[model samples]
Target: MKQAATASLLAFTAGFVDTAGFIALFGLFTAHVTGNFVLIGASLADFHPGILGKLLALPVFILAVAFARIYVLGREKRGHDGAGGLLVAELVFLSAFLAAGVAAAPFTDADAPLTILTGQLAVVAMAVQNAASRTVFAKLSPTTVMTGNVTQIVIDAVDLLGGASAGAEIKARLKKMAPPVVTFALGAMAGALGYVALGFWCIAAPITSVVLIFFLRRGAASA
Candidate 1:
């Protein structure tokens, strides 16, 4: 149950940041790097002016993930929970992203230096999250990307629905996969709406969620 709650919260945060970034930055995805790649290609082909941010996002994300791996490895060497450290790093980046974004508000130019920096920070924050999910939270279901989750959910549903003899394993898998997907959708909606209503300050939603998770993890560890 704890794992599920953490995963769902992280999924919600990813969806929230991704949607908020997308709407605020003229369709740049903060959490979904693959989407940014497609956008980069499209921008290149069409000579789009906003391509710089998308292009920079990829490398910045890679750098963030690499940094996270190094940080985790270092922490592990010292006999510590690397995941917790990674979460802290993510929070720092996210806070920076939020600050930069708010400071650069009324973004009319996507290629502007401040706009690109804000987008890059957001990408880095999500990249840290992606790295942590793969390394620190490897035991849990992925919370950021939904492609594999959706595929598994569909397969599990088919097995359960096709036969009354379907075992508890199928049900367990569904239970594990369903919440993140649902919560991600909800977060996306909330992010879009929040961005429309509150501009860059909408990031406070995810920041608060992460802070909560950090404290929850700390409490769990201490207990």
Candidate 2:
């Protein structure tokens, strides 16, 4: 239950920061890889290289996942510490990036170095969020984006309640149907509220996530 709560809060934080990036700079959503992939393609053709943004995003996100996987594997071999805390670290860095951006100036300014640096920070944070979401928690809400999760949830509900299958199949369908429905909604609601009310301090989302990480880490240490 506690882990679920942690994942939910982190997911919400990811979305909140990503949306802020959307509002502040390009409407490009850093967490939504599917959309970002398309954007990358469009960018190739259009003048929106957004190249630096994508550059920061793609590789760092991959590395975050790799690092988390390695950490989680070590914890697993040692027989303690679930895979969650590594992700929490990722989220903390993500929040730091977003907060830094909040402290930065408008994009219209020609200060290329600071702009690129902070801009990279923002997208890379989201990239880490994406990697954590999709890679770390298969059943959990991966934040950043929801097209795939939303589609699968609808498919499960309709296929199950639609009565195409029976008994075990129905149970299995519903079982699969469960997590994303709740978590995604939770992420959306929290993300909306945080970004709306807090502006840049919307970082409170991951701050809450860090608290969860602390508890999870304590559990590992005790074990």
Candidate 3:
């Protein structure tokens, strides 16, 4: 139960940050970094100005994931839980993202130095989250991206509808995948609305959500 809840929160954070950053930074995808490739192509074709930030996102994301893996491996080697530390690192980067975004709000140029800095902070934070999902939280459904989760959920649903023999497994997969998808959609909507209503200050909600997840994971670990 706790794992599910934590995963949901993490999904929400990713959705919220990605959407908010996209809107604020001219379509920069902090969580779904690959999406930036498409945006970069579009920029090149259209001669847009935000290409630099989009160009930098991929390498920054790769480096962040590498840092996360090293941190997790070091912790595990010393007999410490890596997830908690990764969560803390994510929170710190997220807080920095929020601070940078708030300070650099009302952005007029996506390729501006401060704008790129803010976007990279968010990318790093989400990269840590992606690494955590693939590492210490491998048992949990992916929280950053929803394409696979939605695909699995649909497959399971179709099987259940067709009266497949693996009903139990289908149902289990649905239960595991549904919450993150739903929460991610909700977070995306909320993020769009929040950014429109409050600008970058709206990021505080996701920051708070991460704090809750940190405690939730700690409590679950002790339990």
Candidate 4:
């Protein structure tokens, strides 16, 4: 349950699954809002989905937060994953959802109900991961987000050179941050490989995600 290993598992899994969501589910990026915006905008301009699709996805970001709070409450109620457990369960749900999506895909084509259902499912997962990462890493700092992580790494590097007391904190932060960066990169690489080798066999996303979560939950238990 080293921080490094936990990050390695979560980041790689996030990237791999998020990339799969993007590839298989038409352009939804499960983790990052930057990519989400690009996809949503394009879909709006082109597809102009009925309120149902947007309605389905509209509250996902909010729902992610709600899910995080639910985890928070779960800990408060039973004191399980503590605050960190919230993040762990978030990843756990994503893994479970991906499995559901893999099984549910055929029934859902490019149509509204199917897309809406799938979008809602993924959105809920992203919402959980997003809020959990934001809170869990507030102290140690979380790197599950590549866009923010890269930006902060630059900022931290600058702060490290400032000869301030906070430099120690910055260095500490970067140490925790490193694993996610590396793991996410590996996921991106693996995603490309899987897409090439498997083609429509995108079932790799959910299956590998389940494996990652299984290991992650094991790590969390021992943590």
Candidate 3 on 1-223: residue-level lDDT in tens? 9989988999999999999999999999999999988887786678777788888999999999999999989988999889878888998998998888888788998778999999999999999999999999999999999999999988889889999999998898899999999999989999999999999889998999989987897787688
True-vs-predicted CA distance for residue 164, candidate 2, Å = 4.1
Candidate 4 local lDDT, 1-223, one digit each (tens):
4546656665775677667666666665666645655556676678733334444454666766876777676776775655456545555666555566655654345455656566566666666656656655444335346877778888888777877678778887788777688888887677667755664355346446536655765777787
* Cα-based TM-score, every candidate: 0.95, 0.71, 0.97, 0.71
| Best of the two (3, 4) by TM-score | 3
Per-residue lDDT value at 13 in model 1: 94
- RMSD vs true structure, all candidates: 1.5, 4.0, 1.0, 4.1
Error of 1 at 214 (Å): 1.6
Q: Superposing every Cα of model 2 onto the true structure, what RMSD results?
A: 4.0
Query: How many residue pairs clash in model 4?
Result: 3
Model 1 agreement with the true structure over 134-186: per-residue lDDT tens digits? 99999788988989999999888888889847669889888988998988888
How close to the true structure is residue 35 of candidate 3, measured as C-alpha lDDT? 97
Model 2, poorest ten-residue lDDT window? 172-181
TM-score of 4: 0.71
**How high is the lDDT of residue 9 in model 4?**
63
Backbone collisions counted per model: 0, 0, 0, 3
